[model samples]
Target: MLTSKQKKYLKSEAHSLKPIFQIGKDGVSHKQAMTILDALEKKELIKVKLLDTCPLTVQQAALEISMQTKAEVVHIIGHTIILYKESEKEIYKLP
Candidate 1:
């Protein structure tokens, strides 16, 4: 879980990032999860978009993806969701 301050910080940091991943009608797959994991390692924070064709809502997709990848859901606005995780390499931090 993230504190209010942390969430606020992450939200601001993610504002400039474009959605790097998307969840469509097929939902999340194992391969996609692995891909996201790799991205997370390098980026630490990212934005994901859930298309209308997706069976789940933005919030649901955000939470599910966060759970699968061990990241945190910073926010879900419209069809966009922001995610954050601290890099083990310490190359990036979630603020």
Candidate 2:
């Protein structure tokens, strides 16, 4: 689990990032999970948007994706969720 300070820092960092993935009517899929995993590996932090057509709520989609990709849910605002994972070679150190 992330500390409150870490989450706060991540929230600020994510503010400038564009959503890298969108969950639509089909909800989360294996392909999406793979993409998220890859993005997390490369970037360490990512944002995902839950579209209006998505069957799950922002929280649900975030939880499911977090579980699949083994990433932490840093924040969720409106329809967007921020996720963070430490890359083996290029980990992001939280303040």
Candidate 3:
């Protein structure tokens, strides 16, 4: 779990980041989840975009990604969602 302060800091860090993944009409898929897991492994913190066409809520998407990757939802603003999982190569500490 992330502390409020940590989450706040992560939100700020994520502000300028562009979404690396896009959730389109097809929505989240098992294959996408696998790809996202790979990305999460490579980048401890990253952003994802949820398209308006998707029926699922951003929260739902975030929940699905977190549950799938065993990561944390750092923040969700507008159509972008931030996710974090400590890098296995090194302990990527949160602020």
Candidate 4:
């Protein structure tokens, strides 16, 4: 779990990042989740974008992806979601 300050810091750090993945009409799938897990292992923080054709809402997609990847949903704005998981590399030093 992340504290408010940590989430804030992560949000700022992710601001300039492009979405590494996208949830489209097919919605979230096991394969997609697993792929996201792999990405999370490499990058502690990542952005996921939801397209207009997606079946799930932003909150639902965030919940499902976070649950599957065991990553925290740091922030959701517009159609983008910022997720964070502490990786082995300890890439970002959160305050």
- Count of steric clashes across candidates, in order: 0, 0, 0, 0
Q: Model 3, poorest ten-residue lDDT window?
A: 86-95
TM-score of each: 0.89, 0.94, 0.89, 0.98
**Model 1, span 7-69: residue lDDT tens:** 998888888889999899998877888899899998888888888899987777777788889
- The sequence of per-residue lDDT tens digits that candidate 3 reaches over residues 13-85 is 7777778999989888989988998988887788999999988899999999899888899988888889988
Instruction: Identify the leading candidate in terms of TM-score.
Output: 4
Give the runs in model 3 whose Cα sits over 4 Å from its true position: none
Writing each residue's lDDT as its tens digit, candidate 4 over 1-95 gives 89999998998899899999999999999999999999999998999999999999999999999999999999999999999999989999989
Q: For residues 22-94, write the lDDT of model 2, one tens digit per residue.
A: 8999999989899999999999999998899999988889989999999999998999999999888766677
Local accuracy by lDDT, each model: 0.84, 0.92, 0.86, 0.96
Error of 1 at 30 (Å): 1.6
Q: Give the better candidate number (2 or 3) by TM-score.
A: 2
Q: Following a full C-alpha superposition, what root-mean-square deviation does model 3 have from the true structure?
A: 1.5
Model 3: what TM-score? Answer: 0.89
Clash pairs for candidate 2: none
Q: What is the model-wide C-alpha lDDT for candidate 4?
A: 0.96
Error in Å for residue 50 of model 2:
0.8
Question: Mind sharing the TM-score for model 2?
Answer: 0.94
Distance (Å) between predicted and true CA of 23, model 4? 0.5
